[model samples]
Target: MDNTRLPLLSTETPLRADAVRNRARLLEAAARLSAEHGAAAITMESVAAAAGVGKGTVSRRFGDRNGLLQALLDHAEQGFQASFLSGPPPLGPGADPAARLRAFGPALLHHQRANRDLYLAAEPAPDRRFLVPAGRLRHTHVAVLVRAILPDADADLLAHTLLSSVDVVLVDHLLRGHGMSLDRVEAGWHDLVDRLLP
Candidate 1:
């Protein structure tokens, strides 16, 4: 179906603000629904139903199923950043760099646990020849914090390797698949950091 069928973006330029809104509403609903149910159970129709919009409206807003899935992942990433940047320390800021970085991995693991569907939906296909590159800005963020603890260390590479440890899939495998608890993960993180640092 044509996006034009849903609603125009505006009167003058032919774009519909209402449709834009409906799209955001659909994503919101999709997040909630996926969290409550599972990603496999989430459907465009379900999101539309929850958003109080037509399925066509949902399609117009997101373009298709892949678009909906990508949007959900985007939403989850934004939340992950927000939670880490501002939620609370030791997850957020108030803690020392050692403590902050120490908390970062576990906080991310916990975040993934709570938002598993969003996380799973966002994961890229494994066939890609090259791995996802680290975002320089985020690495800079980690580097700044890590540098404070180990002034002579290569914060860049450390952040690169260590940041990956926070990944949910890895945590899920190590914990659920291995029968480990959150505290075990947390302790393990501290031990690694100590060995790597000083």
Candidate 2:
């Protein structure tokens, strides 16, 4: 068990430990509001009220609503990244590369589903979508695994293809418009991986 606390943000000016905890608390409150009432329900004032802080505190921490939302997304992304990077089992460090590759899809699917509203609301313009840090990180991780499993293949391109298959927007459409279950989506990932393995 790695006990290291991953920094939520990179900063030249280090935040006091208390400040870090306070910001996390506000983000947690905002996430709770988002989960319970939807992204539309999370406002600066509402987050402040939920965190038992003054609205000014929220303002100081995030600058504005968009900044707050971006931070919330980053906070969520960091946890998901950490789970695959260092946490236990097939999703994390302990499992073989092939097993980890198979696990990535379902892990990502659930992460996106849990954060669906926020992801959809904060979605960048189509041209900008693949450029986001979180998306890039996931792609890089997948590519690394693909390279390990199929060194002769174009892992970079294949990673994109694999990720696109379970893309959040596509999954939402399948789940909502086509009534496709997540289990089916996850199974599809496993099937794809099995076919790709030589």
Q: Which candidate should be chosen as best, given lDDT against the real structure?
A: 2
CA RMSD, predictions in order: 4.9, 7.1
Task: Enumerate residue pairs that collide in model 2.
Answer: none
Which ranges in model 2 have alpha carbons more than 4 Å from their true place? Answer: 1-15
| Clash list (residue pairs), candidate 1 | 8-15, 8-16, 9-14, 9-15, 9-16, 10-14, 10-15, 10-16
Candidate 2 residue-wise lDDT, 77-98, digit = tens:
9999999999898999889889
lDDT, each prediction: 0.73, 0.92
Residue 37 in model 1: shift from native, Å? 1.7
lDDT of the structure predicted as candidate 1: 0.73
Could you tell me the lDDT of residue 46 within candidate 1? 86
lDDT of 1 by residue, 111-140 (tens): 677677656556667763125432344466
